[model samples]
Target: MENNIASTDNDQRVRGYCAYDWGKSAFETSVTTAIFPAWFAYLFMEANGISMKVLGSEWTADAMFSAAVMIGALFVAICAPSLGVIADRRMIKMWWLRVLTILGSVSCILLALSPYLGVSVGWIWAMIMFMAANVGLNGAGVFYNALLPHMGDESEMDAISNKAFASGYLGGGLLLLVHLLMVTFIVDESGSVQSWVIPFAMASSGIWWLGFAQMTFKMVPEPHIENEMEPMGLIASTKMALGEVKKTLMGIKEFRTLFIYMIAYFCFIDGINSVTALSGVFGIVVLGLTVSGLIATILIIQFVAAPAAIGFTKLAEKWGTKKALQFSLVCWCFVIVGALSFAPLELENHDEYDIQYTWDEGNNTYVATAREGVNNIAALPDDGEQQWALEYEDILPVAENEDYDGGYAVKWAYEKDGTPTQVAVSLNATSLAALEGTMDESRFSYSISGGEFANSTGLGVEHPTSLGDGKLDFIPKTARSLVWEPLGLSVFFQFLLLGVFGGALLGGSQGLARSMFGQMVPETRSAEFFGFFGFFGKVAALLGPLIYSLMTVWFDSRVGIFAISLLIVAGAIILRNVDVEDGIAVAKAEDERNRASA
Candidate 1:
């Protein structure tokens, strides 16, 4: 009966643990990846008009977002070790987890107020709230990950860890899909989406996170502390925690392979995480994709990643965990390289036509008058072949003219191959005269469109080729033309395709990496060691974004992106040297020693 009861409890605990991932993933997907970044970008654009002055330097919305994430990560890196030690010494892991979850959820909910805060300070408030929420999310993750060793044995670690990641993807993806639908359908009178809809989506993510975490609170029991220290005041406990951390640092050679793995993890995970965090912002700023497009792409990643994570467990079993992980890292390198070359095509053709205007002295306004017989005309150099064309909207005059109707002729001039080919769309003289008459009355608006002209000119607008006029301006422009444009695919399709490839590797890499670490960490000191694990990860997280931000500010975002690829490569090379069997042996021996001493 006792054995059955214990089995049931373990099963419940595993489910509960996975539930926490499901809960928190809402925050990651809806708030971090999908909605908040785009909403913040919109707010920043509305307030500061594309760039903001920071420290007397003009910074783009993406750079500021990266900086905010860097600050939060740096703060958590400094605190994770001591916090980890305290949780190890006391029965405080669950309590700390709860506290951090509340902090994160509340901060996320409060973000809805950003729209009401006035444009001048709305983005500023949003950034501060986002930073606080990130601190909570990252801080909670330290304690959350520490529970892995206690939940299952080494043999089951990969399955259990990957299952949690899969659960997270499903939970996060579902919510993001719902939010995407909401944003897509909710439009204002102008057919543009209402800005407030996104902020509401952000709040919903926090609510989802907090609401689902109750399962974890109810089912996962706080682990018992072995060799428990006597209760002390906060300051005393902090000092003791610091001393314990120092001892572990000094004894690092005892687990040399583990430490070596941590160093490699620190390097590579930084690159992985930075790519994940900045992808939405990158799309908005660089690719010029809409929020809906970014959300759709992230949703694709989430659904693909959930199943991919489970598939990786099988791969880990057949190929060994470390080898499987290395494969994913190689895939990541390719993804990043592909991202650096992702130049989006400008499909929309909206050119400013040179329309001649005369100042109307009679009404104190500018009158757009016809250069020839037509009031508004677009003239292109026509070749002998009927390749070039002009398209414009049907015109309507405020006043009726008997001699003119809203019809235009396609008159094209300039000959090729000794052929005078002239096609022009024109308005009748009376309507043209009326259009000029109503120019001062604010009663007319005009628009133009043409696809053949764009095709003939080969003038699709591309993203800026130079990474700004800076130190890296000398870097050759490789991503000037859209890579997939020749195939007649939208840039969003490219992002969707990339997301699938990235998604397949995302959860697999992280899940297997964490599982491998859990297998090598002594269960007796799980929290303490996992704290150091979080410390390394959080600290590593700091460097990637900081480097990316600095590179972006000093040179350009492209250089920043290129710089991240180098970290992943360097880390992968170092990871090849770590001996997994030796690390596992040391972990088992340490656990045995601890049990004997106790």
Candidate 2:
């Protein structure tokens, strides 16, 4: 029975990693990337608009989202280290994961109710829920990541970590696709889904939580030496944690590099995140794309890129992590450039003829064709008239009750075509130069058809017109004709190459770090130090969003994102410099020095 129990425990530990991957995937995709942001924006748009004191008092939905992320980051930074310490103290680690996972998952389920809440209350609730969920997700991730050193041999760490990341990408992508299908195809006309959607999502998360909770309870053994020897009180514990954190900071040799790298990561990642948040919004507002179009586009990106992200690992192994990461950064640069190429201002105001009025019996209204003609008239929305009779009531005379109908009543023609059309006549330089009455085809092309006019003639307009610019413009001309615009085949190819190669390098390095930890730290301090690792990594969380947010606001979202690429670039540079064998040697020397001093 003891052997069986041990066997089960071993199995649970392995499965725990898988559960962690699944849970994080679900949490991030359902709550973070896919549904929540979109829904938040929808609510914000409905509640008048998203207003921030930051962005010139104007409404920017992206700013609000960024603000929420920053607030969440702050919360994570404060609690993560303390929680990490607390988890190591007793068998409470499983309990923390269980409780917090529930908290996070439940909050996510509540998000489905957002559409029903109406804008004001709903938006606030969403912000709160999102913040709460992120905290839980990050907190749980800290513990889960720490479990890595315990799960595998030192050498397998890279492959394991990379595999875990790949799993997360796949799992999250799958769930997102499912959710999108329901929203897109199954929802009713009122834009509401069958009540089952929320319940199913809630159930999925609950199942995920429950399955993982069991794994944690079974696999991660209680710390061998739980500080049962007069554990500090809660208040005292906080102080103890704070003191230890200070010591950890002061004692670590490469602390400067770690902190600087974290800062750089924070700065550049923020830029990337900001652009991501704003991309769909920019498309909607600036490009006149429908909401459906934007959603479809994002979905397309995920579907196309998930395999690419996974494949990137292989490329990383072949090329090296640093090169791959640098390449991904470059791809991001082009994505930004392509996105901003057609700023909203560049879109010329073209004609969309929506008929606002109709005419009736015997009215002589001056409807222009070339400059003034009858065929140019667009029928009113409700009008079914084949030949609209010009009524006296429809005509607005210059003088009230003045008889233009009595004098040489202006003879006019009414077209009989059932379909409405518009003939746009602009008095621009080209038209002016052509002479008032001379018929000349301008750069914009249009075909005019009307039967019954005294002179029924065809007008040839220009096929395309040049707008306010020289060939050599300040803004780089996008490869507009290409389907992906800035993200052409080459950029995509580069993204694949870099993402694969870099992912492998980072994955391998992270694996190696965990392996070294296993060899160096005693089993008792392993979890605690892993907690410290969380603190170290998450320090970037607060600043990452801040940098991204500020850069986006400062230099437009694209340039801001370009700035973020510097993080991966910098991380690669610093990571390469972190001589692993040397690090181990130094660490051993420091440990001996401490022992001698004692």
Candidate 3:
């Protein structure tokens, strides 16, 4: 961002504050939502097919991701208030922000090592680093958000906040664009993704975060406190925080409306947060979206969300923030139903499947890339133990056949049956056509004969969500038959459509959720009330992902999606009964009493 985020902006300090949002949002959009999910899926698929057996259960990538998100948010949610109290007491908000930023950015950079640590350990390493990085992100946010109130006077703070939000959107969007171009352009000769591209992108995002944050550290001075307490140790601070929480709990009857609103806020916010966090992984693992497609979806969300956020402000002005927020939450329910309705268009083209052989018309040749797992036959060495390997002879016709015109020749070179040293296969255009005609797909592509995920390998394979739905995948099934197939759109296009609609709802709901609460809270208790606001928001962040993860483990991913939708519906119902005017009156009365006593 420019030193002044805008030429019209006169305040250098405001630019500094906005700069921090610009820097850190790279982590939010690029590493968390865009790249890591697809990258981890690729690693996990190589290490453990579909799901890894752990604790007598299958752990899929999406579940692991949600668990990581839950753990990260849980840590921050529990400790953030105490940490905020400590920062305010010591007047060292900037100092703590700098430290946590390093922790997060460095952890992001460390993710690049996942590949080089060996294939077997790569996925696990990523999970560990991802958890650590998230801890830094959410933890640092404790102090980051604390600094916002100090950015400008009450009159200017809201506009300053809006500008920072815009900066984050633009910064994150640009970073995602860079990453998208890297993955799209950097490829092996055969057009497969190069291993180093993702690693380089990961490291670069970390650098972007830490590098641009220097401007903020310099320009945004530590907030001045009127009666700053001496910094205390962790135990002392925790005790003080607990005492404050007790007082808040004691005030329930006095601020009944606010507490009720908070509960509704918790349920709905958690659902929306989890959906945003896990959408990328779900697209990759279940829908089989390419790396390019997932990034594109996030990029679409990034740009679309900015304008939508502003548009919601207009809506709030017209309908009132409370009603506008309720409307947005209602739209969220529809979004969830729409998400469950996403089924891949039945694959018809030769180029659609993951491991496929397709004729290249431009080159007049056949091209193929093989997969490792197939019907227990295509297994490789594991833990120095020999395993069955799929032999080329099984796929190619016998050369001694009478009709064999010698247009195709196949040879497998190896030191051991379990490991192949080399494979050489050549076929002319006519011979390849003949082989394609003779080849039975069942022989080439296999299935897991028995298990929960007994998926057949082929172009027209249904999405995992559809498989989970079994005979009752009625919504998505009807959807594909009626809408997707009729329009002749690919799954990527369908994913984009979801992104556009969902992104708008997401942006509006999130932007309005806080603004509506702000309007109802008293100015005198801004710090205390907003602290609880942040607490509910952060704690709720973990809840949705945790529920999604658990439901995914117990049932299926689509079941997880269904479970979260119910949460939004619950929150919206609760929200309808909240009296916004009564809450505002209570807040005003409380502030007046405190001022008179002082």
Best by TM-score: 1
| Model 2 residue 136 CA deviation in Å | 1.2
Q: RMSD in angstroms, all models?
A: 11.3, 11.4, 9.0
Error of 1 at 73 (Å): 2.0
Against the correct fold, how does model 2 do in TM-score? 0.63
What TM-score goes with each of the models?
0.75, 0.63, 0.73
Q: Which stretches of candidate 2 lie over 4 Å from their true place?
A: 1-12, 41-65, 89-91, 112-123, 190-230, 254-478, 481-555, 584-598
In order, the Cα lDDT scores of the candidates are 0.74, 0.48, 0.69
Tens digit per residue, CA lDDT, model 1, 411-521: 322232222222233444454444444334221123233221221111212222213343443332334342455565555776787799999999999999999999899
| lDDT value, candidate 3, whole model | 0.69
User: lDDT per residue, candidate 3, 1-598, as tens digits?
Assistant: 6854643344777888879878899999889877887788778777776577789997877778778877887887777665665564566788988998998999999999999999799888998988888888877776776666566543344455556666777788999898888777788765667889898878888889888789899888886655567777778878987776678679788888888998999899988888887787677666657666766787888888777776776777677777888898888888878877787776554334333443445565433433322111221223111111223343331122222122112222223222323222344445434434433322233222112222323322233423333433677778888987898877788889889988787767875666556555665454456667777988777678779889888877778888998889889988987888898788778767755664
Candidate 1 versus the native: TM-score?
0.75
lDDT score of model 1? 0.74
What is the alpha-carbon lDDT for the whole of candidate 2?
Answer: 0.48
**Residue 383 miss distance in model 1 (angstroms):** 37
